[model samples]
Target chain A: MSASGYVQHYSAKVSDIYFIRPIKMFKSRFKFAQTKVAVGALLLLSCLPFAATAASLEAQLSQYAATAKAANPGFAGFSAARGEALHTRNFASGKPDTPACTSCHGKDPRSAGQTLTGKRIEAVALSVSPSRYADPAKVEKWFKRNCNEVIGRECTAQEKGDWLTFVGSR
Target chain B: MKFPTRPVSLGLLVLAFSALVFSRAQAGGGHYYPPVVDPVVKEECGSCHLAFPAAMLPAASWKRMMGELENHFGDNAAVDPALARKITAYLVANAGDAAGQRYSAKLLRGVDAASAPQRITALPQWVREHRKVPDWEWRHKDVRSKANCTACHADAELGYYED
Candidate 1:
C-alpha cells in the first residue's frame, strides 16, 4: 500500500475509535444501569434544587429563632399556632384597607391571593410553593412591608419565626 | 421610451413621507407605554404591581415618587437609599419628558410640567381615553384598579395595549 493510503487508513480508525466507541459505551452503560438504582438516583438528582432552597429557608428560620432567644431571656420557642393567629389577626391601628395580613394574603395561606391593585400573589405555604422564603433579603423585604401595612409596626423576631414556622409546617 | 423619472420620484417621496407620519402618529397616540426594561426597576417595583413604564410620568414625578417611597400611596415601599437612587435614575432617564421619547408627548399633552403628576391614570389623556369605561367595570373584582392595565389590555406587560 502507498504511504498516504496507510496514513489515511490509520486516521479513519483513530476517528472511529475516538468518536464512536464512547457513544456506544455510554449506550451500553445506560442500558445496563436501567434499574431501581437508576430511578432512585434520578429522583435524588431532580430533588436537589428544592432541597437546597428548603435548607436555606430552614437555616434562616433557625437564625431568626436564635436571635429571638438571645434578645429576651424570657423568650420561649416559636409556635406554629401563634403564627397562624398572627397571620389571621386584624389590627385597626394599621391602614384600614389592610387591617389584616389576610386582607391581601387571603384567608388561606395555601391558596393564592391578590393585591389591592389586582396583581395575583403566589401561595405562601411551603408545601404549595416550595421556593418561598429562599432568599433572606426578599423574605425580609416583604415582612417589613406587610407587617407595617397590616400591624402598623415592624414584626418582632419571634413573630417572624412563628409565622415562618406556621407557613412551613403547612 | 421615457422613464417618467419626475412623477415616479414624487410619488415615492409622498409614499415615504406618509408612512413616516402614520408611524409617528401610531407611536404618539394611545398605543402602549414601553414596559420596564431594567432588572432592578422590575424587581423592586414589580413585586406588588406591574412595574409601570417610566415613560408614563415625567422625570419630576419619578423623582418625587422615589423621594417619598416611605409613604408611597399610603404604603411603606421604601428601599435602600442606594437602590432607590438607581431606580430613580432609571425612571427619570426614560420619563415622558426625557430626550428621544416623542411617543410620550401625547400622554403628556395636557399635563402641566410644573404639577409633576404621580398617577398615570390621573393624566388628562388617560382619563379621556378611559372615559367610556363604566363605573361598575372599575369596581369589578377583576378590574379593581385602573393601575391593573393588564386586566383589560391582556398584553400590557408585553407593551401592547391595543383594545
Candidate 2:
C-alpha cells in the first residue's frame, strides 16, 4: 500500500488498541508488533509442510483404528511395543525371503532398508523420513504387499495402526 | 547421497537420458543401460528392485515376465490387469530387440529372443562380465544381492554400471 494509506490505517488501529500510550511509544510498539507478526507468520509458513504430513499420518492411523474398532468392540489402542515386535517378529507362513518386515526394512527404523531384490527402501521412522507415510494409497499398497509377503496375508487394521504408530513415533 | 527410489514423470527426459547413454556407448563402454523413464513402469517395477532397463531383455522376455507377475521370481507381484498391460507395453516397446539398442546387443547375444529369458543376471554376457568378481565380494554385507547394482556401481540409479 502507499505509505500515506498504510499510515492512516496504522493510526486507526493504534488508536483503537493503544491510544493510552504516548504517540512516540506507540510508534515503537507498532514496529515491535509488526516484527513479531512477521516472525510468527514466517514460522507458521515453515511448518506447513511438516504439519500436513503429521495430520495425514495421524488421519491414516485413526482410519485404521476406526476399522479395527468396528471389527472388534474390544479393540484397544495400538501398542508401540507390539508394533515393534511385529516389525521384527519372523513369520513362518509367508514367503521365506521376507520372514519379517525387518527382513527388508532393516532392523533399525532410522536407517534405510534394502528389498530382497536389493532396491533401497527409505527409512520408516517418521523422524528420519517425515514425508514417507504422507500418502494413504501409497502406504496402504505397500502394507498390503509387504504384509502379504511377510505375514502371508493382508495386515489387520490393528496391526497396520500399531505399525504406523511405532514408525511415526520414531 | 540419496537416490530417488521413486522416479517422477521423466518420460519426456528420455531424450536427455539417451544422449548420456549414447555418449557413454561411444566411449566403447557397454556398461550403461537406460533407466526406466515411465513413472508407472518405474514405480511398479522398481519398488522391490532396480527398474531394470527394458533394453536389457528382448520383447519375448518382458512378454513372458509380465504374463507371470503373480509368481514373479517367486514373489506375488501381481498388479491389476489394466496396469499390468501398461507396464507390459512399455517394457515390450523398449526391449533390447524392439528398440535401437547397441549396448545390450552383446548382452543378449547367443540367446534366442523366442526363448524369453527371465533373469537378466543369468544373461551370458552378464555372467561373463562379473566372472572376475570374487565370490567374497558378492557375499559382502552390502553387496549381498546380485540385483543390488548400486552396491558397487555407485551410479547404478542413473543407469551407469561401470566396472
**Top-lDDT structure, candidate number:** 1
Which 10 consecutive positions of candidate 1 chain B have the poorest summed lDDT?
B24-33
**Per-residue lDDT over B22-122 for candidate 1, one digit per residue giving the tens place of the 0 to 100 score:** 88667844576899999989989987899998888999999999999988988889999999989999999999899998657778998986788998999
Candidate 2 local lDDT, B81-158, one digit each (tens): 999999999998888898566667778889899999999999999999899999999988878889888888888778
Give interface RMSD (Å), model 1: 0.8
TM-score of each: 0.81, 0.75
- All models: lDDT? 0.89, 0.88
RMSD in Å for model 2:
13.5
- Native contacts retained, all candidates in order: 0.83, 0.66
